[model samples]
Target: MAPNSSAPHTPERPGTPVIPGFAHRRVEVAEGVALHAAVGGAGRPIVLLHGFPQTHLMWRHVAADLAADHTVICPDLRGYGASDKPAATGPAVYAKRTMAADVVALARALGHERFALAGHDRGALVAFRAGLDHPGAISHLACLDVLPTPDMWDVLHGRDAAVGFHLYLMAQPPGLPERLIAADADAFFGHFLDLWAEDPAAVPPAVRAAYLEACRNAVPSIVADYRASATVDADDDLADRAAGNRLRMPVTVLQQDWGAALGYDAAGLWRAWAPDLRHATVDCGHFMAEEAPGRVAAELRWLLAR
Candidate 1:
């Protein structure tokens, strides 16, 4: 279920420290739920959506530079950072549809009728869905280290699916994985923070600890999100494919070149989905924003220019 915009913004979960030039705000989109957002810079808003485990802080280095020329808005995706985590609604609200609504609403709340977008990991999924679902509202899009939700599952089926064991495990009977993850929050959440990071040391100790704690705190909502992917999300993508609607806006994609293992035609796949597409692989891990902020910023600049 969606939250009420009239509800107070209460502190629910821990958040990464707001860096310099960035000011954090809590905005109510629905009746009772408010999203925690960080804003900085000026002109032509460029919103940053973070991946799993990490909050908007993941875009700190990148957002800092973009802040100079672009109004940077970074939000803790619903249920992840300080955002509302109401009782998980039906599979639809947790669906990327709902998540994208949170982003669209967040931008509108911040006076952004149009903006550029960049998302990392789970945020990337949200960005893709938002770009598709609200094509007219977004001007430019950049996705880091992810494929479309349906393509992700379709390509990963059977033998290739083992890479994302979390998906399989999260898809299992809910209470089990949710409880297991919640039980040893630090260990469960920190495992990915350690593994997925190309440079584990890039994230400070305090930051890593904070991210693990947030993941631990939001396990139920997070699991609910992944569970939706197996149900409603799968169906949504099928409908989209059946409709043959591709992104009409300019898109820039950055990935780890998992093409070798995933057997995905990265550029070709994006070309099929986006009308104007620029796709490339980086010599980095899944966490491109954190590992290579300079290169990522450079690519983003190039993408925006195009």
Candidate 2:
């Protein structure tokens, strides 16, 4: 199917307007799904994936800066922002495997058979899968503020799990999670924008509104995406580990000191999966791309240089 130009537009979230000098287009990456991507600049391709509750607009600061020398492609993952949100068939439908394939297809469709890839939050999980499953296709991988599905599950036990209450809630068997979230979508989704950010002002009012609206519209798909992580996604990660599969590409992980909170070696866990790894803690919160784009962009450049 061609890009649906007639899709209903959220009044508050027009598009990625914060990032100047970029053209927005929806490219069909799968049989029924198409990703809404912002393409900008020209050079080596670098695809950036945004986290939850935010769209490609989260890459506004970093993408523009990287666009000077690198072709920055920021896409709203399936079920988020302006991208196609298909009904959740099962855990497999929203598995990171499926989402990772979308990224590969999106890049190839845009003439980048191989490219540098970076993702934040939920996007990071997809990128991790991309690096592991399609090593030949990703030259370098950068993940911000996330762990592999298995590692994530390993660390969440008691009080630490409280921090990720949303995860447990969304991982439930569907119906209730969607209904509860839809009841007060703005308040539910907007809470994360405020709670997860060290500096709440990092995400400006307009951008925050855009994120909230996007999440409100994408509640079911977003929940399905998370629910997959707890079930099918975790199983995939464990299977890969049992098979001794690791990401061979150069990898850089920028995260907060979640290790201290979770009582596990965050860097060590990532090091086990990525042989060529550079893991470090950032001072900012989970939304590092928006909270500290300069630092995030610098790290991405470093990953490319490696």
Clashes per model (N, Cα, C within 3 A): 8, 0
Lowest lDDT 10-residue stretch of candidate 1 = 3-12
lDDT agreement with native, every candidate: 0.82, 0.89
Query: For model 2, how does the per-residue alpha-carbon lDDT over 1-306 read when each residue is reduced to its tens digit?
Result: 652222222223444355787877678888888888888999999999999888999999999999999999998999898888999987778899999999999898888999999999999999999998999999999999999989988888977688889999999997999999999999999889889999998998888877887898899999999999989999999999999999999999999999887789999999999989999899998899988889999999989998
- After superposition, the stretches of candidate 1 with alpha carbons farther than 4 Å from their true spots are 1-16
Residue pairs with colliding backbones in model 1 are 1-89, 4-30, 4-31, 4-32, 4-33, 5-30, 5-31, 6-31
Measured by TM-score, how close is model 2 to the native structure? 0.95
Clashing pairs in 2: none
Best by TM-score: 2
For candidate 1, write residues 1-306 as lDDT tens digits: 354232223334445456577877787766666788888899888889999878888898999999889999888888888887877756776788888888888888778888888898889988988998998888899999988877788678677777799988888766898888888888877878888888987788867876776787799988988887888877887788799988888899999988887776877777778879888889877778888999999998888887
Q: Provide the clash count, candidate 2.
A: 0
